[model samples]
Target: MKRLLLFILLSVFCLSLPLSAKAEGLRFGVPPWPGVTVKSEVVCQILEAMGYKTSQLEIGPPIIYKGLTTDDVDAFLAGWIPQQNEMFLPLKEKKAIDVVAINVDEAGTSLCVPTYVWEAGVRSIADLAAHAEKFDSTIYSIEIGSGMQVSTEDMIANNVAGLGGWNQISSTTPVMLSAVQERIRGKKWVVFHGWQPHWMNFQLDMKYLEGVPGTEKLVSNSVVYTVVSNDFAKRYPQPYAFLKKFYVSGAVQSEWINDFGFKKIAPEKVASDWIVANLDTVGEWLEGVTAADGSAGIDAVRSRFAN
Candidate 1:
């Protein structure tokens, strides 16, 4: 009887212990964009608190989408629409990728000019030809193979809004922004692909162009969603649930961008500080989510964030 009692006690003790302190590791696809970098970091910290290991892969959107469909990448937080439709829509239609949720809705991405230039009569993409000399018939872009570059290419090919003969100048986001900054400082005419929820919108006095040939729907309001592999929900329902509930306003993300990029704060510190101060908001994301040990996710995050 004593031996049986000892055996039962041992089983009870084993059951009482939490499951692996670190569950399956999650990989997040993070582009070089500051907003997504900070946002992904925040999500990583939250998931880690829930006993899940997390990692961020810094790559461009096209490669990330390919990774998702092939099961190489688990989650991607920077799925920008309209601009990314070429890469995102087809897979979405085939049911090859799962869009978990729209994390930001108030973002805008398009050809933009300095506000002074806007006031100087270059209010739309069509107006570029009239003053092509001032702009040097050049449209600047971020990164060579970006979705923005694709749109710029289409516009050039179709001569959309008379963009024919207009050439593209491509570089990374910071370099593109630096060119804009230099041009704007001298009051020179410049046009480039621009987006909000970025430090550029905050630091530069620029305006997104109006009346592009296509993009009639939400042209000025780009939507960003959290996307994952097709079977993410079924494979990791707990973390999936938390991610499904993760949403942040464009204003909030812009603030985070400014904090991390402009203010020079580290992304991890920004995410950690935000979670520590906004537990109530974090609680909402963890509403029906749980840790690997089958405990409330909020409880684990709370303990992790608690000083």
Candidate 2:
């Protein structure tokens, strides 16, 4: 009878422990871009409210994907398709990672010039070379080793848009934008890498150039995806399921990015404010999902962020 009583006590003690005690905390990779930063925070905040411990690592794209493959990072929310296709395809082929969901769509990157430049007879990629003197034969881009930078290089090497001797300036996003702002103020001609779901679209008076003939591939629209290491779903099914339901439209994502990128709000504050304002939408992401302790996920989030 003593043995039976001790077994019962042990079982009760085991059941009393929180589920998170037995589960590994999630590690999310956040790229430098504002949109992805905001998205990562939104996911992390919701998971935290669901009783899961989480951490955000500020890693760039190449490292993020490699980390996902090696299980160093559990997930990344900024896998921009087509633009990132070259980076994601091999790992996907090896079954090293899984794209959980398309978080944002109708997104894209391309060479863009200020509206004044556009209005001044520079409406297409083909027009850039004609005004090369005004643009100083330069195209500004963010970071070395980015897909956009590579594409810009290809354009220069291949002499696309007659840019045979052109130069692509490499810099961070903030520096590139600051240059754009300066150019806009001076009403000077400037061409730079541009994409949606970014504050630049709203803040700058610019237009994406029409693709040059035979170079259409460089200006294609892209879809941003949430990606996870292959083992993530099996290891953390609740958070995985919640992540799969996550979806943010291009327009809405741009708004979140603008709040963080332009308004200079903290990413967590931007996420929380969006969550508080869009409870109905947040509920959709939590549908059929549960907290780490098997409680209703939506209820936990609502209670935690009720203010």
All candidates: TM-score:
0.88, 0.89
- Best candidate per lDDT, number? 2
Q: Candidate 2: global Cα-lDDT?
A: 0.82
Worst ten in a row by lDDT for model 1: 14-23
113: Cα error in model 2, Å: 0.5
| Candidate 2, 36-86: lDDT as tens digits | 889889889999999999988765677778878876789989888777667
Global lDDT of each model?
Answer: 0.81, 0.82
Query: How much does candidate 1 score in TM-score?
Result: 0.88
